[model samples]
Target: MGGINLNGLFIKPPSSLLAEAYDALDPNGNITIKWDIISWTPDGYVAVVTMFNFQQYRHISAPGWTLSWTWAKKEVIWTMMGGQATDQGDCSRYKTSPPHCCKKTPSIVDLLPGTPYNQQIANCCKGGVINSWAQEPNNYGSSFQLSVGAAGTTNKTVKPPKNFTLLAPGPGYTCGPAVVGHPSKFISQDGRRVTQAMMTWNVTCTYSQFLAQKTPTCCVSLSSFYNETIVPCPTCTCGCQNNDTHPGSCVNPRSPYLASVVNGPGKNSLTPLVQCTKHMCPIRVHWHVKLNYKEYWRVKVTITNFNYRMNYSQWNLVVQHPNFDNLTQIFSFNYKPLTPYTSINDTAMLWGVKFYNDFLNQAGPMGNVQSELLFRKDKSTFTFEKGWAFPRRVYFNGDNCVMPPPEAYPHLPNAGSRLKFSIFIFFMTSLTLFFLFE
Candidate 1:
């Protein structure tokens, strides 16, 4: 028999395809968790765990990352530096100086800044906030040291942790099982000495926008000086403005209780409480074709926040357009070129300048920041017609925004129609002259 039969139903081995998270602009983006056993203790071992954010634009923000995993063989944390477990689960078994954590599954968070000297390690603090590899390569990783009591002391006896999970303050990342890899090597800061670890393992995690949120956090609008019509963000691009069913979904700009609502405890919740608008999006990106010049063209970009309670700090925007390669100057924002595709140099990462526009404030009059870009025109491929000046794609804080339909974009005035009218006028004038002369 090819399969087993139960109650007239044939059963066979199970198999199915797995769904994966992918981004066209950032196809190779991921976070790697590395665990290296630096020393062997009497009972167990001491290991250093580090996290590296390899994504091009995505970063872990304040109230930062949380890393968790299930130990393979009854591991208990005896001591920790640079980070700590969220719980001291059932340390009651040890009466005198109990283990730092006594749990099979543990969640760890990075120690905040200004930690005591004894508790600090290299790349340890900053509240677990990590920038993307492209934006801040120097600050792209976080590290912590931990001493385990029950884990095996020898490399052969030790096993890797399972079910690793990463929440960079929130879900969207899916981690794979930790597997042993080549030994890790460490070098002294002075670059004079080096040391090698006895064992090492790694866990890689990928993010999925679909798993993160159903609705987009931002939207893009378009406008041009040549056309009077402005294409607005798509209606309900983020969510519908439902009042009766979900009273707390959004707040009116003029609501008297706005202050109390925004300052309430629920303000810190994961879901954003945005200002009521047609788009109902927390953030809006407006791109305007401001001016046209002989050799260079100008475009103005504006980012506005509608969230009542939250402020976006260390935020960044990514834009893709053909003219980015010829970009001359950006007015206020600091920019860095991102060459994810390698062959295409059209992507750019822009962020607010520190101490001025770095912090995007809550929904109000002062909630927006803007910058203007000047780009040298490439005569071979440059054209104002058919919305050629508009960006091909836009992303805010690494999350893609919904773009308005191409047909709705403002079009150039019909030059062909004017030419037709001029020809008809000339034909009428010639016919009148001939008839008069005859």
Candidate 2:
């Protein structure tokens, strides 16, 4: 867009003609009223405009003082009202006073970039008498039309969206929800909820051609904050002991990790069995991973059925190795499960199940479970230079570890158990059928 009049368009109304009301008209209905742009700084621009009023029969100042050229399209419509004639009965024709209050006012607006702009003036009054006044011969009224100015272009920066937040457990929380695959949290008071979030864009563009106008735009930013809530501290009240929801023998009756007892261990009469008959069954300690967007997993394991011999001599923990199939013994008196279960090391040992062995066995005098020969893959097979008795904890392969494929029926109960009895009856019936057929 080019600049308007170099010397600036200035208008000095003739003193002889008093400021009076005039109605402007044009074929296009209401004409747009605007002052030509006089001048402007490199940074800012100014525009002048006036509107004709019917009641006073003269022009008046329009509400929006700073006329914006972009808004001109919607503001140009005008109207005119004519007054009654002396004859009283509807005077359809011209009368002594101009009945058309806005009749003489021109409604069209035209902007010129350079040549001095001109305006035509005409008077409209109550009685219908139209008085035409002098204007530059080629033009219309007593209005001073000035050229329109161009608005300066600005380079705006698009702002990004606010960070996404997981609302529960409140903000600034670093701990994540348990269970890697589960949804982390529900919506909280502050509106933070789901961890996953995304951003969408909107743009305004003209459908048609060259020289067409387009809307300015910006970019959006997206982010998220993850918070974790510890599964409501598992209720210790009911005395549920197993993390896996096992049946009988409440192992680790106080731990939140143990789901529940699936079953109990052997009942031996020899040992003073302080059988926690209904317990949080010991989990074959395995790693439970919590994953965020990042790759690294926070691994944790909870060992149930930690038999701390009342004699304070033996400390035994049945743990499910990280790889899943292996069942291993962690400690036994001469060996204590990773650091004698001090308040501090208890948490560390649980989470370090999957880390390097040297560090894991560093539990000092507490690292037992070093007996039993490896029937299959043995930890000792790997170099354990840092002075460890057993290469890796070992267990009875035939008894401790036998993972049936997913489709296989789980272990059957002992003989005379419900399943065994059912099987016995079935075989007997088959034999009887064979005899009958014979």
Q: What are the lDDT figures for the candidates, one per model?
A: 0.87, 0.22
Candidate 1: C-alpha RMSD after superposition: 10.5
Q: Which candidate leads the pack in lDDT?
A: 1
| lDDT tens readout by residue for model 1, 116-156 | 98999888888989988777756778889999988888988
Query: What residue runs in model 1 are displaced by over 4 Å at the alpha carbon?
Result: 1-21, 416-438
Give candidate 2's TM-score. Answer: 0.15
In the range 52-130, model 2's lDDT, one tens digit per residue, is: 1111111111110111111211111111111111122232443445221122212222222232223221211211111
RMSD of each: 10.5, 36.2
Give the range where candidate 2 is weakest over 10 consecutive residues by summed lDDT: 215-224
Span of 10 residues, lowest total lDDT, candidate 1: 8-17
lDDT of 2: 0.22
